[model samples]
Target: MKIALIGAGEVALCLATEFCKSEDEVVVLTSTVKPSLKDLKAEIRLTDYSVENLKKNLDDCDAVVSTLSGPNEFYISAHSNILEACRQSRKCKHFIPSEWNINIEDFPDQPMFSAATHEVVRNKLRSQNDIKWTMICHGWFMEYLLPTKKNPLREIGLAWAMNHGTKVFDMYADGLQKVTLTSTADAARAVLAVLRDSINTGADLPPVTHLAGQTLTYRDLFQLIRTRDPAWKSNPVTFVEVLTAIHEGLKANDALVAIHQMRIMGFTNANHNPKGKALEWGTGILQGLRATSVEEFLDQSEAGEDK
Candidate 1:
C-alpha cells in the first residue's frame, strides 16, 4: 500500500524502514520548506505541512501514519496541521497517529506523558466521515533500558535508570509489575501488519494490541543484566533507591522535569503501575540472554552484547 508517513524521527524512521523492507511505497512528508530528500530511502515530498498542502498530499495517498511527537514543540504543531489537512483532503483510508507508548487510560491522574493535543486530533478525526483512525499504544521500548547507538545512556560501561544501584522500582508496580515492551523492529512490524490487513477497515478497530519481550520487573531486568556481566553483581542498583528518587520527584511536581535532568535521556515507568491483563509480544529479544538474578542486569550491561 502507498502510505505517507509524517515526521522523520526514530519511530518514523523505524516504521518507514520496515514498510520499505516489505515493498510498500512509503512517502515521508517533511515541512522543512525545502527538505533535502537525497539520502532518504523513502520517496520524499516537501510542503509546509500546512492544512492546505497536507490536503494536496493526501489526495495522492491511500493512508497516513503520523510519528509526530507531543514533547517536541515543532512536531506537535505540525501534527495539528496534518490533522486539519487530513480532514480537508478526505482521501486517506487509515491514519495512524503517533501513540506508541503507555496507554493514556492506564493512568487517569498522571499527566506527565499524556498526548492531550494528539488525543483531541484523534477525536476530531474519528468524528469526521472521511477518514479511519487507529492509535498505537505499545508500552516503553525495551532498548530504552539498554544502551543503543542513539541512546547514549551507556557510557564507558554503565547505564542508569531512576535507581542508582540500590532501589528496585516497578515498570508498573513496586518491583512486581509485568508491563509490556517491544523492540524497534517488532513494534514497527506490528503496525505494518495492521495497515496491510484488510480486516482493519472503517470505524471498527482492534480494541488493543500489546507487544513485549517478557513481562517482568526492574529487579528482573537487573538480574538479567547481572547474569550477563559479572561486574554488576558487586555494586548493583537497588529498587528502594530508584523508587525513592521517583517519589521525591513526583512530590516536587517535577517527574517529567527529572527526565531532562538525568544524564541518560530515556523514558521508563516512574512508579504507578498499569492495571488489567496485558498481552505479551516479542519473546525473541530475550532468548540467548540470561539475567535471572539481581547480579544479572548489571553484569550483562557491562559484559553482554551491545543490543
Candidate 2:
C-alpha cells in the first residue's frame, strides 16, 4: 500500500518513520524538508498546499494522513486544499485528518479556537462520501513531560500543565481529574495499525479512535515527577481560577489561553476515555500493540540522561 503523509512535523515524522518499516511505500509531502526528515527512509516532496499541487502529488496514493499544524485559518485552508486534492485525485480514498488531540465531538468550538476550525473540516468531510475518513484523538502527547534532550519529539512551545526545566507544575481543581497520555511513538503505531486493519478487512475506519498509553490524574503525574525529583513543586489552581483565566486570556488574545483551557478539560475528566474504546480497539483491531506507559517513559528518559 502507498501512503501520503502531509506535513513534516513531529507527528508526520513519527508516522513516516513507522510506516516505512513496512513494505508499503511512504511519501512525505511538506513545504520544507527539515533535517530530521532527511534521515527517514521515505520519498519526500516539497510543495505548497495549493489544490493543484496537492492533487498532482497525491496521485496514485492509497491513503493520505495529515499531521499539519499551524494557526487556525492556516489549518482550515490547508486541510481544505488536501481534501479537495483527494477528491480530484480519485484514487486516494482514505484520509486521516490532523486531529491528534482530545475528542472534539464532545466539546465542539470550546476550550480552543482551533476546535472550531476542526469542526469546519469535519463538516466538509461529512458533505462528501467518496473519502473514508477518521480522526484519532489520543489526548495530550506524553513527551511534553520531558525536556527536549530526553525525547525525540519536537518542542511545542509552552509545555502543557508542567515545566520540567523550571520544576514548576499546575494543579487544576485538586488535580484529581483523569487525563489520557500517549507517547508519539505509540500514537504512530496505533495509527499504522488502524490503517493496516482498514486495508486488510475492507472496513471503514471509525469516525473517532482513541489511543491511550496511560491515564492518570494531575496529582498522580506530580507524584511521578516528584519520584524522579523530590524538589518538583505544584501550584494549585482552582476550577474558578482556571475559568477566569481562560475568560481573561481569550479577551486579551493571550497565547496561553489554550493551555488554560486544556487544564480545565483535564480537571473535568474531559480528556479521559471512560468507555475503554482505546483498549477494545487495541486488543481487537490493533492486535496487542502495547503502548508505552508513563512510568516506562520516565525510566527511558532517566536512562537517556545517564548516558
Q: For all candidates, what are the clash counts?
A: 33, 0
Candidate 2 colliding pairs: none
lDDT by residue for model 2 over 1-307, one digit each (tens)? 7899999877777778888887888899989869988888899998799999999999889889999977888898999998889889968878999988875556555456577778888899888887888988887788888876765676644336777677788787778877788888788777777877787678987788888778888899889888878989998777788779889998999988876766667566667755556645447776877888898988887887789
When summed lDDT is taken over every stretch of 10 residues in candidate 2, the lowest stretch is: 150-159
TM-score of each: 0.68, 0.91
lDDT, residue 41, candidate 1 = 69
lDDT of 1: 0.55
Expressed as tens digits, the lDDT of each residue in 32-122 for candidate 1 is: 6233345556888777767788888877777788877655565566766776776676566567777665554454223343445555555
Please give the range of 10 consecutive residues that has the lowest summed lDDT in model 1. 263-272
- Candidate 1 steric clashes: 33
